[model samples]
Target: MTVGYVMLCHTALDRAAQVARFWAEAGCPVVIHVDARVSDKAFASFGRVLGDLANVSFSRRYRCEWGTWSLVAASLAASEQLIARHPEARHVYLASGSCLPLRPAQDLADYLAKRPDTDFIESVTTEEVGWTMGGLDIERFTLRFPFSWKRQRWIFDRYVDLQRRLKIRRRMPAGLVPHLGSQWWCLSRATLKAILEDPERPAIDRFFRRVWIPDESYFQTLVRQHSRKVESRSLTLFKFDYEGKPHIFYDDHLQLLRRSDCFVARKIWPNAERLYRSFLEPQEGVQIRAEPQPGKIDRLFSKAVERRQRGRPGLYMQSRFPRRDHENGKTSSQYSVFQGFAELFDDFPGWLTRATGVGRVHGHLFAPEGVEFAGGERLANGALTADASLRDYNPQAFLTNLIWNTRGERQCFQFGPRDHQGVDWFMATDPNAQISVISGAWSVPLFRSDLPFATVRAEAARLQRIETRYLEILRSMYVKARVRIWTMSDFIENPMEPLQAIVDEISPRAARRLTEPPQMVDLTGFGRFLQNLRNEGMKPTLMGDFPVNGDPRIAAPRGRRPYLVQ
Candidate 1:
């Protein structure tokens, strides 16, 4: 279930890098394509942050235009580079770097592994007219325009309405049926390879070159026609306002985002750093698979940062006295391991009490009220009291086959996922799933995702024992780990302001049009030229208001360099 990521981003390298790093650290190979419409300073900085990662790569920039062929071209270019770079990656996840993971990596990985043959793509046939904006599927497929529709979209749409009123129907390319859906997807590598290697791709590319919002239709149509195994769903969650653009995630959307049962969520705005960070951190009952590390002592130990952090308003968890006691004295040396365990197995029953023979506070083990097992099946009947004889309290009987893998020690004890109890141990990848996996000082729970609860639980029982043991030891080395959802103290100053203000900040003389609102011309010499070509029975493979060598109209080779962003 190894995966690769292909991110198409046009702005905010800082935000994009965080997402790239998140996926890269999760062991997925990542390929990024920055829209050539972005500023050079932005592209260069984005490269610096992401290029350092061994698993990350970049495609030559493309001046991707919305609602035009360039966007599809960029996606195909990125796919080629991505699949070539990660030949073994079973799935290639297409996303904007602004997208954030809703579940931990392992959860997504496990979900894909369970359905290894299924492709998570949202594709519906051309007959599904409701998907077309205002049911204008024909307008998107039949029209051929030289200018981008996004700019002056009203002009193109007015023409479309005029055509409908006048009963004008243009013929579509000979044998193709248009399909439309969200562009974001987790495509099977075999399917992607088929797309890249398909002999008819050039012909299909030519037909869609002029289609409005080709990004929405190009891959959807081709993959539907070419592949048989599709789930008709995308792994990324998105919410669109009436205008059809993705809404920005904010502080208030946190809980809604958590319970969405999605692996990724998108349309993250730049200033929404706090929201992004929370997704990266383990939420309650969800232990995000660890990021690669031997902690950076300098950052963790910096007194200045610590003081600053303490002054800021943030969520902090104080461990129960038993773990805190273990964290004191010589035991504190394993603080990361202890912290990892605490965050992961926050409420696993009898863990810190007179159970597992770790540290029995009172002769009787006490669990938090409503403790649950791997399948989210609860066992604890009531509150955590000093009373030794709670109605449903049992020491060893609570959980059998408990195991731990300590950081510094190598010895006899061993445990992993294949163990039947794993389903009850690491709560099936639900942020709400109540089980967790604890190895000595470290513990992790199931990451949240879209898999059915039964599947998740059953799958947990089938995971390799080594995967469990390996991850626990791997995640336990980070000291003071816990769930953190940040909020802006110097807050709520228009999120888009920073994006707009970048012009003045980075390079003032850069092209000003890329940032402008979407619009297109009704009459242009280039538009006429494209229409003339179609009238002449010419089927051009690629068409756009993009510079190919010298002139925007001149045809360019498949892998030529981009002119705008540099």
Candidate 2:
């Protein structure tokens, strides 16, 4: 006993004919159902092309609309014809027009012949099925779906909602529980005949007519009652995406299909000439007779779904720009932001490059004039230009691109109240950011500037206000960055410890004890500067307590002089 194929063809009749001829030439009866939507001229031509094959026949035509009863009717007509016309056929395999045979017809027939009484179909109760889309589970069976979900979505949704609100539910025909699965299945002759010729078939069909996507549920549920043995899986390889849409295989999937070992694979791209040629043409060597294992390639499909949903971290592409706070990672890699470091240290960028053993350090990147790229280049990695107009247009994108482009290298850049503050919150929330802040350090530049006292006072107040607001954001509960804050007075008292900690965090694997420290800009009269600001009616609270004695450094406590050991 051989296997007969019942194909549902809605488009690409030529490809259907090709596959049909392949099966018929292998001694299997083929019954095809073409959708009524096809033009008469096309249907007549399709029929003439296959008219030479006596084993091939066409069933009654039906206008099959997706997610409607017409699809079930078309399948029923085709299945009935396949059973009656081909008495020698032991099993009926359902397939779609786009499906291509991945293995030889004899292999599939031999496989089915081994399990003559076994029906291969995916059958599971609705409660156990987690793959259903559209938020309909058991409700798909209880609620009447008169409107087409695709064509009349508005009415379909409203009708479902109205039924839900009024608590209307339909009763299932006795002895049948709702089951859902893939539409492609292979049923033994006994099960197919029993389901089609059952005495209660009229009642069962009438009830399932209003069930949403009944083609997937009709045979899947009835086979449990009629079949003596069920394999609970399909011989065809069918995969759906996160959105419940089938993944169409193209020419590039040639090797992927061969690895599945499935008898047939569906939803192939119509123009995939390579796939058709490679899969349809029989291989002349010894064929592997292992069972079909679709699970072998499941990892590839899972990764494809993950990449489509949550893209690689910190990548902002035109095709998949994520919403705010919804990114997998705000920035691609870890980087350092030095707030107030440049002002307090002489040649800070150069010193940092040496200390961290990294070469990507730069001056204030968000400076008003232009981006201070490493070595003052006009452009940076990933062709990121130093044009201030473009950088300021989207400061967040500029910074994210910088980190993404310079990945695998630790990037260090200075930031201050003087630079653009647009990216304040972004850096504060990014987990990849390592921010070392010294409050009131912005006043150091003002004091060192040769400007008038009045101008310095006004400028200090503005910078102070910006830094205060920025500090508030850093201290907020939403912050994810690794932060270390020290006031100007506090940092001067003990600076080496904080610097060592920052460097170690940036390059933990290669970090050693700090033997050489960056030279601090002389703060001899810096205390007087703070005292002067306080005396000028502008209180500088962010600087902490400063001694009026003019010296900012506190000498380390010294031990008593050591005497001779004798």
Candidate 3:
């Protein structure tokens, strides 16, 4: 049995596109249903970033208001789109754009192949004990509001309360039982086809169109009434916190996620994009995030300083990477939202090479966070441009710090161009790294910004001519610092271009292995971290499946694991 994907998305197009691309790369056919309320320009932006992929398609726009029937409408539309094109698909996987698949597609499909007739969805009958938290409210199935009742605090809710006080209950249609569960599920094709084709399909659909949060009940009720072969369990994992919404997945949840047996998890946000990216990459061994312990806190710090003092430089690790604003002492965010590329710095040659300059080093920023951050409805391939800096950086000024580190004792060095008319990279090796201006041309500006600020149109395109020099300077600095395999640490969602460009420019030997991409092994080799998914009969992604990491340069150091410094 083959598998297909149906994603329900509202915002964060880049995050959505990244998830879509992950599945597309996994050899699954994907259908997306973006909310109709999204502006055409925003939807178009998603399309533009995704470009022309062979296996991906979008559903017709439908008004998808929260806690309303329109969400189910959008989901139904996506399932239709997937089934219409890929009838051979046995199961239609339903999830949100923010949802991530924990198991490999092949494994999940193989598991489903073993049981072809059963529909997998979470369901609790209205009469079931603890069906709706405190108990199922009668008004949910009886509500007849034309618009989303959640939007107006007074109108529908007050009226519904009045009706309840008067004991006016709308009776459910005979033979139709009310069932509720998560809005997302992986339905069997037979179940989907039956639900879509049932003579009562239209009747049921129209019946729930006025129900509040119909998405949670519509499919649940239909599958229960229609299918005898049904699994009362959802394939998607969720932790509905106190707010009744799935907790947002973040870096800390890596272990929990990897260990989950569920095929999918929901409520992932952009800050966690790097975690998903790492999951997709699959190279750096099992991901295990540990909270800092109180006992070893001061010891770790003193030991690090002592080691550095003794010529045995201790590694400096901080998982909570913040935006550049934090470095300048101006950030209010507890942690930086972008850490995908930063993690690369801790891997293989990244740590092995850059460790050559250990204490107090300042790297340049090409694509920064916040200003040219992974923000907006940026889908994919929305390369960072110079003009984007105008929103944050001075219009007349050029060159802002993207990244820097502590590589030397009492000495801080920064690598960036003096001006961008042309591009070159430089670093101060002494404590005088904070100099106001260069005294001479040995530190000469490679490219002097000459064109009047008025002539600038597309900042990135306008400056594309000299980006080569910018890259060259970066390569030269890496060479000068003797940092091996200088991995680009700026990009998040779109790392291929910058990664390939840097590799092709600096080290051609390592660039070839990236050609074929990563491959997945069968599910029998699944990782042991799946508790949530395993409990549900869902398997983790195929074992031995890893991100592209065969290149000797990117590979973990030959002998032993890098010392832990975090």
Best by lDDT: 2
Model 1: weakest 10-residue lDDT segment is: 484-493
lDDT of 1 by residue, 389-424 (tens): 442343222221111212222111112332223222
**Model 3 CA deviation exceeding 4 Å by range:** 129-136, 282-566
TM-score of 3: 0.49
Per-model C-alpha lDDT, please? Answer: 0.54, 0.91, 0.53
User: Which of 1 and 2 is the better model by lDDT?
Assistant: 2
TM-score winner = 2
How many angstroms is residue 103 displaced in model 3 relative to the true structure, after the best TM-score fit? Answer: 2.6
Candidates in order, TM-scores: namely 0.49, 0.95, 0.49
Model 3 per-residue lDDT tens digits across residues 1-566: 48898988888878888888877777788998888888999999998877767788998888777777778888888888888898778888898878876655666777788778888888887666253542334567875656545678578666667766787666666688888877778788988988888886777777787777788788888898777688877777665543354557788777667655556777776778566775655453443233212233334434644443332212212432222212222111111111122323323223212323222222222334322222222221223343444523542122222221222222222222223222122221111122221111111111123544233222322233343344454345343322212222112123355444533433344443345211211222112222323354443221112233232123334587789888
Candidate with more favorable, higher lDDT: 1 or 3? 1
What's the residue-level lDDT of 320 in candidate 2?
69
